[model samples]
Target: MNPDNREWERVDEKMILVMRLTGAGKSYFIQQLTGMNVSAGHELKVHILYLANFVAGTEKCQVIQTSIGNTDFAIMDTPGFDGTTRSDAEILKVITEQLSIIRLGYNLKGIVYLHRITDNRMGGSAMRSLDIFEKLVGEDALSNVVLATTMWGNVVDIAAANRRDSELREEYWGSMRRRGSTATRFDGTRESARAIVEQLLGKKAVVLKVQEELVDREMSLNQTAAGVLLELEVYAEAEQIRKRLEQLESELKYEKDSNKRLEVKRSQRRNAKAFSQCAEDKKTMKSKPGVEVKGKLKKWAESGGKIGLQALQGLAAIVSISFGIAGFILGAGF
Candidate 1:
C-alpha cells in the first residue's frame, strides 16, 4: 500500500471482470472458465464477498472470484435492480455498494452484461438494469460492458432462432460506438465453455477428446473395433429414400393399370350397346309381312324341331297304351 499506490497493474494487464445479472449463472460461468470446482465445498479459495455491509451494515453484495489459468479475474453476480420488489431494492443497493468498492479498492477491466437467451422480450426490467449500470459505471464504463447472452445452451439455433439478442445489444449500446465494447454470444455448456475460453485467450480451436466419465473396466476380449457408425447412418438414410421412391412408383403403376381397365370396360360396353341396337333394328324390320319367311323357318329349325314333333309322338303313345289295355281285358273275358 505504501510502495505501489496503484490498485491495478496496467492497461494490458491480463485481468478480466465478469459481471452478469441474476440467474445468468455468473458463478457457474466463472467456475467453468477457470475449470475450478466452485461448488458448496469443492477445494477452492473462491468466496462470495458481501458488498452490502461495505457501504451499509444492513445491505450486502455477492462477488465470485476464481483464477483462470494464470490470470485472476473477478466475477460479479448482481441482483435484480428493477425496484419492483422489496428484495430487489436491497440487491440494487448491494450492486451500488459493490461498484463503489470496485472503483475505490480494485481496478476495473471489462464488464460482462449477462442476459438470458430466453428473455427475448426486453421489458422495463432490462431497461432499468441497463440504466442502473450506466449510472453506476458512468459513460466511460460503456466500453467495459460486454453484452453476453447467457443460458445459451437453451437456444437450439443460434443463427436461426427468433431471439431478440441483436436488438437488445443494439438498443443498449448502439450510440456507444466510441467505447467499442464488442458483443459476443456464448453457449453455457462444456463445449461452449471451452470455445468461449479459447476466444477469450485468443487461441486456436482445440479438439477436446471424448472421455468416459462413468465406471471403467479392463476388457478381457482384446479386439479392434471398426467405426461403422457413419456407414450405418448412410445405409439407413438410403433405405428410407429407396422405400419412398418404390411406394411412389407402385402408386403410379396402379393408377395407370386402373385407367387402362376402365378404358377397356368402356369400349366393351359401347360395342355391346351397338350390337343390341342393331338387333332391335333387325327385329323391327322383320315384324313387317313383306320380310322373308325363310328366316322364320330357320328359327324353328334352331329350336331343335322337338317343340312340334315331340308333342305329336307323346299323344300317339298315350293312345297306343290305352288300346293295348282294352284288348287284353276283352281277350280274358272271351
Candidate 2:
C-alpha cells in the first residue's frame, strides 16, 4: 500500500482527538488499536507534545499529538498528574485551548473519553466533569464522545464482567443522553476495541490478531455482512429462515428430553408410594395376623395396585419358598 494515497489518511481528513483521564489504559488502547509498540521495555524516552497557537499576547489553541502507527495522531491526555494541577482546571484549560483552535480554523472531529474498567463504579467527579465538558463542547460533540472502558483482562468472570461493562455503557450513555450528549461503549477487549476503531475509521478495518482473550469465537466476514444486511431487512430472508428453523429444532429436542425426565420421575414416585403401602400392610399382618393380612391383600388386589406392588410381592414369594424348603428338610432329617 502506498503510504500517501492510503485510506488510512482519512483519519486526518478530520481533526481527530482523544481526550482521556489519567491511567485509563489510554496507552494500551492506543497501542492495540494502532499496532504501535511504545515503552515496551527499555527506556527509549518518548515525549508527548502539546503545541499551542499563540493569539495576541496569550497562547490560545493547542493541539496534543502522539505518534501511533505511521500517523501523528492528536490526543488530549486530561487530568494531568501534576500535584498543583486540578482535574477541573486541566479540563477548563483544554476547553479553552480547543475553542481557540476552532477560532483559528481547526475543525474538531471527535472525542473519546477513556474510562477505567478496574473501577466498576463511575466517579461522581468524572460524571460532573463530563457534564461540564459536554455543555462547553456542545451536543454535537456528543456524537464524538466515546466512553472507553478498559482493562477487561483482569476480570475473573469474563462473561459476567462483560455484562457489567455493557450495563455501565447503557447507564453512561443514558446519562449522556439526559445531558444531550451522544455516546457509545468502547469496552477495550481485543474484539470490541477493534470494532470501535473500525467504526471510527468509517470502514471495515483489517485486524491482525495479536492475542485472544475473552472472545468466545471469531465471527467471519460473511456472518458479519449477513448480520448487517439483516438489520436493514434486506435480501437475506432465506438465511434468516434457515437460522430460525435450526433454533426450532434445538427447542424441540430440549422439550423432548424434558418430557422424558418428567415421565421417569412420575413412574418412580408411583413405585415409591406403592412400596410404602406394602410395608404398612406387612406391619398390619404382624399386628393382626390372618384377618388383617387377608383384608389388606384383598384391598390391594382390588385397587389396581398389582403392577406397582409387583417388586415387593416378588420378595415375599422368595421368602415363602425359603421357608417351605426349610420345613421339608427339617421334617425329613428328624
Candidate 3:
C-alpha cells in the first residue's frame, strides 16, 4: 500500500498540529490527550533528541490518530523549532513536507503552540520560533491559533508564574491575542488537554500562509514568507557577530593580562565560527529551486533601484540561485 493512501485511510479525521520549542511538553500533552505512551523526556537533551520517538507506532512528523467524544482526530506531533540535532531550516523543511502531505485532502482544524511557564524570559530562539510561526500562519488565520503555556506543575513560585502569564498576554503574545488568537494554560492533565483540543473542534479548516505560498503560489522554501524571515534573521545575526568580532579584535590588542587576551581570542574564534554557520545556513536556504521570477532583471529595473543596497544584495543572491525577488520584500514586513 502507498504511504499517502495509508495516511488518508480515514478521511473523516480532523487534523491538528501540536508545535513548540523542545521540552515544552508537546509529547506529554499528546500522551495525555490520546492515552498513548509517547515518551516525554524530562532531561533537556533527551527531550530535544527523542521526544518524537514513539507515537502511534510512527516516528517524527507522523500523525497520531485518536478519538475524543465522537470527533476523530489525526494529531501531528511536530519536531521542535529548536532541535539540538537539526537546524531551524531543516526543521521547517520537515514541517513543510508534512504540511504538503496534509494538504492533499485533510482539514487542518487548528494549531497549538506551547510555551514553558518556567522560562524566566522570552529568549531569542523562542522569539524567532514565534516570528517564523506568525509568518507561516499569516494574520488571516490567527483565529485558529492557540497559544498554550505548559509546565505549571514544575513552577515553584505561583505568583511569579502568574506574573509571567500576564506578561505573555500583555507583552510577548499581545499582538497575537488581540488579533483573535487565544491564550490558555495546560495543567498537565487529561481533562486540561482535552479542553485545549476541544477549543479547535468547531473552527473551520485554515489554509496557512506557507501552504498557500508553497503549494498554491508555487513558491520555493527560500521564497516563502517564513523562509525569508529566517533568512533575514540569519543575516542580521551574522552582521551582529561581525561587529562583535571587530570589538573583540580591538579588545585583544589593548589587553595587558595574558589571561584576558586569551579570553578575547576565544571569543573571536567563537564569533567567527557562528558567522560561518550563518553563511552556510543562507546557502541551505537558497539551495532548493522553486518558482522562478520571470524577467527577473526587468522587475529589478522597474523597482527604481529603491529596495535598498541590502535588499539589492539579497536580490542578487536570489537571482544567482534562481529564487524569486519577493523574499526581499517579505523581509520588509519584519
- For this target, which candidate reaches the highest TM-score against the unseen true structure? 3
In candidate 1, residue 249 scores what lDDT?
Answer: 52
Per-model C-alpha RMSD: 48.8, 37.3, 13.7
153: Cα error in model 3, Å: 1.2
Candidate 1 lDDT over residue span 106-192, tens digit each = 345555666777775776667656655554444544555556777767877776444477675677656654455556676665455
In candidate 3, how many clashes are counted?
Answer: 0
Clashing pairs in 2: none
lDDT of 2 by residue, 33-57 (tens): 5443433221112233211222222
The local distance difference test score of each candidate is: 0.40, 0.38, 0.69
Give the lowest summed-lDDT range of ten residues in model 1.
Answer: 321-330
Candidate 1: stretches off by over 4 Å? 1-18, 36-60, 82-89, 156-163, 190-334
Taking the candidates one at a time, how many backbone clashes does each contain? 4, 0, 0
| TM-scores vs. true structure, each candidate | 0.44, 0.42, 0.68
Please report how far candidate 1 places residue 217 from its true position, in Å.
66
